[model samples]
Target: MKITKQNIRTALWVTLSVLLVTLLLQNSANVNLRFLHLRAQMPLFAVIMLSALFGAGILWFARRRR
Candidate 1:
């Protein structure tokens, strides 16, 4: 099959997804998380994923067209 931009993106996404899954599976220990005034216990993977989601959301909001 001929290579295209969409195919490249798909491959990258799949690779990232696999890597993320592996990381999450390997790290599941609970840790104390402090957010502003609230403190709570959260899984290590959950904390990382939440931070990633927040970062992605911020980037999308900033880059989206008005």
Candidate 2:
């Protein structure tokens, strides 16, 4: 198989996903989030996943159109 950018990206994503899953499974505690009086209790994994998704969304939107 020829090495390409797509393959590299796929490999990286897969590795990151596996690592994230392992981390999530190990951390299952409730976390408190208080932002300027707005408070919430959420699973550590959920918060991490949501933050990652939010960052990805921002990057996706910020990418220059070609």
Candidate 3:
């Protein structure tokens, strides 16, 4: 199989989507997040997705500045 930039990007996106779906389906329990003096309760999937998005955003921002 030939590997190209588009192919690599597509593969990564498909892999991430599969992982996200698997995690969402397997995690159904509610989770509590404590940050310093703050607290919040949300579904495990939501928390995971939010954290992933936050991390991605930080990476994108850092990359853009370089």
Whose TM-score is greatest here? 2
Summarize candidate 2's per-residue lDDT along 21-58 as a digit string, tens digits: 99888888999998998999999999988898899888
Q: Write candidate 3's Cα lDDT for 1-66 as tens digits.
A: 999999999999999999999998898799999999999999999998888899999999999999
TM-score for candidate 2: 0.86
Write model 1 residue lDDT over 1-66, tens digit each, in one string: 999999999999899889988998999999997879999998999988888789889989989955
Looking at model 1, which ten-residue stretch has the lowest summed lDDT? 57-66
The C-alpha lDDT values of all candidates are: 0.91, 0.92, 0.93
Candidate 1 clashes: the total is 0
Which window of ten consecutive residues has the lowest lDDT sum in model 3? Answer: 19-28
Model 1 RMSD in angstroms: 1.5
TM-score of every candidate relative to the true structure: 0.85, 0.86, 0.85
Sort the candidates on lDDT, descending order: 3, 2, 1
Whichever of 2 and 3 has more lDDT, that candidate is 3
lDDT of 1: 0.91
> Which portions of model 2 miss their true places by more than 4 Å?
64-66
